[model samples]
Target: MADLLTPGLILAAAATFLFAGLVKGVTGMGLPTFAMAVLGSLVSPAAAAALLIVPSFVTNLWQLLAGPAFAGLARRLWPMMAGIVAGTFAGASLLASGDTGASTAALGATLVAYAAWSLLGRQPRAPARLERWASPIVGLATGLVTGATGVFVVPAVPYLQALDLEKDDLVQALGLSFTVSTLALAGALAVRGAYQVGDLAVSTFAVLPALAGMWLGQEIRRRVSPAAFRRWFLVGLLLLGAEMLLRPLF
Candidate 1:
């Protein structure tokens, strides 16, 4: 139990969550990705992921329950959920082995790949029949990344985005996926001893600023073009990912 609540970490957590929340507020997503990019730059991936536990859980839980698709989502996504849980545990074991350099590289690669796909690649829509075979694979990959880096996007977002659900249903489906990912990641960190009492306290404290920023971002979302905002956000993530990928080389 070193000082997990140091002033530097406090500031990092507050600012990172606030910004992450703001991004989510306007774009309706991106908190985990943004938080990890900012905080992972400042802290270890393990620490950054741990710090995100409270906020991620709190925010995404609301998103998960906002609609009537909970039961439908549960039935359809159970395979993916199961994969996320299992893959998170496996990735957590890798993280706990004290090989953070590898995990960091993996995180960077994930970010770069995701950003590249988002910017230049087209995500293919699977027929609903194919999801049964495809969903678990997507969830497992996303979980491995989430477990290693605390960033919860990658195949999961792309997979969800490709689904032909109605707008509201798509949003809720992502929320459901994220909620499951957050819980799985938290369990992984807890097992690895990276998430302890002090971290939990700080994570709890961080929830307020994250929520407030989301509120403010919601207000600003009305004024900003979502298309423009998305492009900028993707570019920012691309830069962050490139930096992450380059760091180990130097």
Candidate 2:
């Protein structure tokens, strides 16, 4: 923790969170993915995961409550959420084992895949009949990925989109899922002894900048084309992913 708080690192973290929040604001997701991508490159994936807990939980909680369809979404998504917790707990040690190189490469690969999928703008729909069986499987896969990389946007986000939910319901659904993932990830990190007093303090401080960035992003969204912004964002993420993937090899 002491080593991570060097003035340069602190500044880098603040900037990273701010940019992450900006993406989340525009796309209604990407906070964790962007943070993990950038911070995992700067620090270990385990350390970056710890730092994102507070901001991610707080913002996603707000998103969860801001809508009127909480009851229905909760009822529909409980199994998947449960699977997330179970899977995260089951794979909790993947990131905690002090294998930074492997985790960083995993994180890079995830970002690259997700960014490519989003760039293609292909929104595959899951039929209503399949939800009964598909949800838990998706949740488990998502949790395993989250456990390993601290990024929960892979199959989970795509699965959520495939539900063909109404726009607002989809957004609220994402909030619910992310909130659960954050809580589960936090527990996993704690079990692995990644959360220390100094780390918690820095993480807490990051929340403010994240919120501010989100606010700014919302304002920007009102004026700019979200689709355009998202396209560019994915491009940058793809490049970042390439760098992360190649980093250890050199």
Candidate 3:
């Protein structure tokens, strides 16, 4: 922990976590996306992943404990969870084997494309019969992306939106998805012996800033109109997509 306490690094990490949390709290997603984009610029991919683990866990802990929605989410999303677990394992193995730059690039491009689709593409509604299968497919794709790039929302958000869930339920859905993906990614990092005590300590320290940001974002959300929220969400998606696309270039 002391090793990571350098003033400059600590300050930067705190700022990054704060920004990420604000995005997630207001938007109900983007914590991982924002964290990885900013932190990855400063640390190795594995280190960035490790540093996010604890903060992500802390952020989701509130959602998991605050609601009764998990059961309904589970019932509606079991197949998706199964697929995510499987895909997460596959992605983790790839990371554990060695370098994951290629995987990261691929995942980033996929995220950019998906973000575009969500903003502009007309998605077909899931058939009544196919609704049962939607979760698994979404889960698998999200898991793969989560494992490879720590960016899972890109795949999960559209599907959840298409379900026409109430805002609270959608929040719960995202919270659940993030919770599962975080655990899977942690396990994968463990298997690859990528777990670093210092990283976890730093990540834990980051939680203070994250929570603070979330509180502020919630306050901001109260003042924003629904249409404004939608516009900002699109803007955020475009910026994040551009960030992902330009990541490997630097």
Per lDDT, the best of the predicted structures is 2
Best by TM-score: 2
Native-to-model Cα distance after best TM-score fit, residue 120 in candidate 2, in Å = 1.4
lDDT of 3 by residue, 1-250 (tens): 2353568877888998898777766866667777876665565556677788988987886776566688887888878878777887777655454455654565456556666776678865666577787778888888877777766675777787778777788778778777888888888787778766666766788899999888877887788764566556656656765765676688
lDDT of 2 by residue, 33-94 (tens): 88988888888999999899889999899889998899999999999999899888776687
Question: Could you tell me the lDDT of residue 9 within candidate 3?
Answer: 71
Ranking by lDDT: 2, 1, 3
Go through the candidates in order and give each one's C-alpha lDDT. 0.83, 0.88, 0.73
The lDDT, on a scale of 0 to 1, for candidate 2 is 0.88
Q: List the residue pairs that clash in candidate 3.
A: 80-135, 80-136
Off-target runs (Cα >4 Å) in candidate 1 are none
Model 2: how large is the Cα RMSD against the reference? 1.1
lDDT score of residue 141 within candidate 3: 81
126-239: candidate 1 lDDT, tens digit per residue: 788888889899889888877777777778888888887888888888899899999998888888787787777778887998999899889989998977988889898888
lDDT of 1 at 94: 62
